[model samples]
Target: MSHTFDASVLREYDIRGIIGQTLGPDDARAIGRSFATLLREAGGETVAIGYDGRMSSPMLEHALCEGLTSGGCNVVRIGLGPTPMLYYAEASSEEIDGGIQITGSHNPPNYNGFKMVFQGRPFFGADIQKLGKIAEEGVWSSGSGEVTERDVMGAYVERLLEGLSGVDVGELADLKVGWDAGNGAAGPALERLAEKLPGEHHLLFTQVDGHFPNHHPDPTVEANLADLRALVAEKKLDFGVAFDGDGDRIGAIDGEGRVIWGDQLLMIYAEDVLKNHAGATIIADVKASRALFDHVAALGGEPLMWKTGHSLIKSKMKETGSPLAGEMSGHVFFADEYYGFDDALYAGVRLIAATARLGQSVTELREAMPAMLNTPEMRFQVDESRKFAAIAEVSERLKTSPGPDVEDVNATDGVRVTTKDGWWLLRASNTQDVLVARAESETKGGLERLMAQIDEQLSLSGLERGESVGH
Candidate 1:
């Protein structure tokens, strides 16, 4: 049987769509068949499969398994867990050849998707397109392969707990922390983790509800962290940490109810990692604050500014031999002592360890960082066909503009322009039909200047700075 996916489902990063519309069991089966065929042709047979708590995940998982076995690839089904657990299964197990995670990630309940890892590396971009071609060809492996179930939660939890070894056990008793899973798939594992943790823990919405009753699973949105902030305040906890739907990205707030962005978290993690691996490379997405890069350099580590996207960052980390990397959206990767994949749970534990080892409270660390005012990531709709063109136009204008310095323009990803006031970034969103822009500066006036420049450039491109953008 052959299947052709809706063009929108095969996104730049993963396969995602509104369920029952752009995605269904049939598409899942086709994906399974195509992915299995790819693995088999690569001289591999076993594919590890896992799913989130989304309502549609179970059916899709079953259908995907059917296709995999039909395509002559054995399947190892590690039922409900976060995406990182599936990554652990693939990375730690020698027998596994590939992995597929059925998670819509931070998308809404009505949406569902797949994140694939071939061997131990992320499978995306061109690899995702290859699945489309294989499905269209109807040329799949011809044999029935076996399927088996394995429970890796205990091992995964234990592996996470191992991160606490560097922490002083005496400090654990003095620590009080809050965690909000936001009813994502990370709930059960979180419950298990809290039980073994050393500090006093308060957890909210630890139940896995695909509906996300409390708030959206995306922690990147400041509003989504309101519950966490209130929890930290009510309990007078040292800090709070929250996770995205699939438990890959993280959101954190300090004791003072201030958000610690992805780059800020990296600053802490870099200090800890650099203590042991000096001169190691640390990577962050272009959207991160310049203060983070400066912090890495101050700590005797090489700092790399790369494009946004978890898969893209992971690939860059491997290429640069970077021990650590993170994204502004809360995707933190640690190859220092763990697999390079982003694991919010592990990141939380490391945060705890970083604080204890560095002899600073999370609040102190947050306060110690260089202060910069920056606009939140502003995403505004542009015609899909015109987004890249708009960015190109802006870049071209900035390059030849007859104005002051025009500062420096880096076209890696989109275009990030650096100026005396600070830096402003304009890039086309990889996953949406929108342009993402952000500007940062040391002073309020400087920040305004950067925003003005951004507005001026957008005006030149026949685009508005932005309209109301939420969600």
Candidate 2:
């Protein structure tokens, strides 16, 4: 039978929507049928699936399993866990050909969605759009495939611990750190990880609760990190690391309770990863700080700036053979000694190991970074039809006029303009009807000038930087 999905749920990266209203079991079933058909056609027979702690997750998972089996795809149910655990199960298995994780990924409790992997590669972009077409066409393969449950959490935790393989045990023993799971899907995995970790660990909200009782699970927003900062301060821990709802993205605080932003975290990872793989190519999103690129270059590694989005970055990592890559949104990917997927839990372990190996505390590493003034990612809602056009308009204007002090324009994903004062970025968010803007500078006056350029660009596009939009 033909199925129709809410157009909004078919996003650039994953299928997502507010529960009941924009999405339901029918859509999940349709997705399962469509995805399974695709996998089978690509010479795959089995698909691994997992879900988060959301109240509606189990229902969706069951429906999805029904659809998968009907489409002649065996289902390996990994039960409740973070997205990375599902990735781990899929990546570590020789029999599993694809995986899907039912997760909202730092969104509100009312929201839920799915992230998929196909043949060990990200299943997104046109692949995500193809699901909608297949569902509408009602061309799913037919069979009653088997379904079985598997517990991969223990094995997943063991793999994460490998991030600290070479670090001195004595140094890790002296470490004291705080972790705030924020009552998201990462809670159970975090608990299991903390138990095995040698450092004195203090955890907050490790009990999985999709309602996000303590605070929001998104660590990118400083406001959501308040609880984590307080925990670090109250306990006098060495530092703190937090996971987003599905534990694919990370947010961290130093010993002094200073927020170590995503790009800053990459600087640390780059330094550590560069030791053995000197002159390796390191990748970061266009939104990352210039300091990170400069730092990577200083460390004798090639710095590559890429478009944002985890799937895009992961694909790029494979294309370029990059050992490590990160985004300003805290999605860190390590292919050095592990699978090239974003795993916040593994990133936290690497943070511990990096500090130990770098011969510096997290606070000291933060202190070593160059001080640059920057604005938090500024997101303003725009009409979906107007978002990309606005960026295009800005790019077209810069090509001809380029105004004063415009040095270079890199339109990799959007337009990043470099000027003497600093640089500013204007891009349309692929997942939402919003235009994202950010600016950075070494001097306060320079930062103000860079921000003005952003405002000027927006004005030229007949748009004002209006009320900030929430992710």
* lDDT of model 1 at position 439: 92
lDDT of 1 by residue, 137-188 (tens): 8888778999999999999999999888867777789899999999999999
Question: How would you encode candidate 2's per-residue C-alpha lDDT over 87-201 as one tens digit per residue?
Answer: 9999999999999999999888999999999999999999998889999999999888999999999999999999988887777787999998888899898999999999799
Lowest summed lDDT window (length 10), candidate 2: 165-174
Off by over 4 Å in 2: none
Task: Enumerate residue pairs that collide in model 1.
Answer: none
* Model 1 lDDT, full chain set: 0.93
| C-alpha lDDT of residue 264 in model 1 | 93
Model 2 clashing residue pairs (backbone):
none
Tell me the TM-score of each prediction against the true structure.
Answer: 0.98, 0.99
**Prediction 2 global C-alpha lDDT:** 0.94
Q: After superposition, which runs of candidate 1 have C-alpha atoms over 4 Å from their true positions? A: 468-471
